[model samples]
Target: MKRLLLSAALFVSITAFAQTYPKYTNEAGTPKSTSKPPAARLKSDGTEMRSETVMPSRITGDFQEIMERAVIQNKEHNYAAAISLYTQALNVANEEQAWRALVSRATTYQTMDKPNLDKAIRDLTTIIDAQNAPQKQLAYIYTCRGRILQEMGDIAGGCADALKAKELGLPVALMAGLEGCK
Candidate 1:
């Protein structure tokens, strides 16, 4: 009798859990259309034109795992291990993931006890030079790099990046540093 009641309770809990959970259509199921609709382009004649949806290449599972581990190491203050793991993740990263990994590494550099701000600038520069990410992300990166430049006494470089970020929709230049930036 006790076993029967326990079994009933387990079944009820499972049913309740299943019903409350949102359905996922990904794993071992039909493919899902996760891509956003392509932007419409106008020809010289001003006619509506359809374009293919641009989907970025997905990063590898290994990249995900390595980044997760790196985050854990970073939170634990294991700077060396975290940086090494972040580098490993970079080697396996795809288009979008490339920016993610680079930014993460740059931040790690910024947070180190004896911070390597120069290396941080280099990593952020790699992202800016790539010019492959969305405008919003580029804006954020520019803002970050600009702040770093300001700290490093490069007022002109900071102003340039800050202005670029403003052009990209994040107007933080004047607030970050007013030096040589009108």
Candidate 2:
């Protein structure tokens, strides 16, 4: 009957919607997380507790903590915080991580202030010239450089770099921004 089909369809839709968000798990193979940040943990006494396994506040040696902060700030469009965190991260970032962070932070800079062409160019240039960098990353470097140049009034150079990036296997998303740069 029509009612039976409608009920089944409603159940399927509800199931799909409920499954959209994944369950969180702890590093020690435990479940039942409350979807809060790792800093909020429960103790045996039913009070809030802070554990090394639950909270990674000790990730201070290298740029991991700073990079995580930068990534989160970038997602939230907090450009100043992202810039500061990325700067701290770059101080300890290895060659590989620095290159990626440069690109990411440069993007945030561009989004924050279109007039910050110099900062964007500097970041992209650093990435493009990284020694022994991965070829795929090189493609991304070219794309970022292309955007910087285009924004800085170097139309021809930007288009050239954009074309080279696509030829070097940058994704369509990167190339899509390159459109009209010519």
Candidate 3:
């Protein structure tokens, strides 16, 4: 009698657990629902509820076009136009595009009549601090920041960045002319 009751209890518990967590889809593997909820639907904490479905923004095409235009503007020596387009690209950019846009904007600033070294430094520092950037790209960013710092008369800071770039495997030729890196 005890064995029978224990077996029944175990079976009941397994059935209850299985019923509580149903499969998200049928055997065909298609999603159970295709409809998405309205974006304005939110919980008390200003977060999306478990039942709410959010769609990802599709803007990579627009981002690429804006970045291309920015590059063209930069090549034409239209620093203001290039900077504006780069900013727009940044708005819709993913991780890779954001880094590229920031670097391009920093380079554009360097060519301006009155270079905004501070802004360039901020942008570069953002990338560095994110820590998810590729090593080669980080090396280039550090080198660029180092050059800007040198231009701004921050010799020690420039040297530090230069050394960092070198440590990250920047070509020896590129570091050859950077003072204090040797």
Worst window of 10 by summed lDDT in candidate 3: 22-31
Better of 1 and 2 by lDDT: 1
Candidate 3 lDDT by residue in tens digits, 37-117: 234547899996541113354333366678779889988888899988877666566544466667667767766777777
The full ranking of all candidates by TM-score, starting with the best, is 3, 1, 2
Model 3 ranges with Cα > 4 A deviation:
1-61
Can you list the residue pairs that collide in candidate 1?
none
**TM-score versus the correct structure, for each prediction:** 0.63, 0.59, 0.64
| lDDT of candidate 1 over 45-98, digit per residue (tens) | 999764222224443446667888998999898988888777766656655556
Q: Regarding TM-score, does 1 or 2 come out ahead?
A: 1
Q: What is the Cα-based TM-score of model 3?
A: 0.64
Q: All candidates' lDDT scores?
A: 0.64, 0.57, 0.62
Cα RMSD (angstroms) for every candidate in the order listed: 19.3, 17.9, 24.9
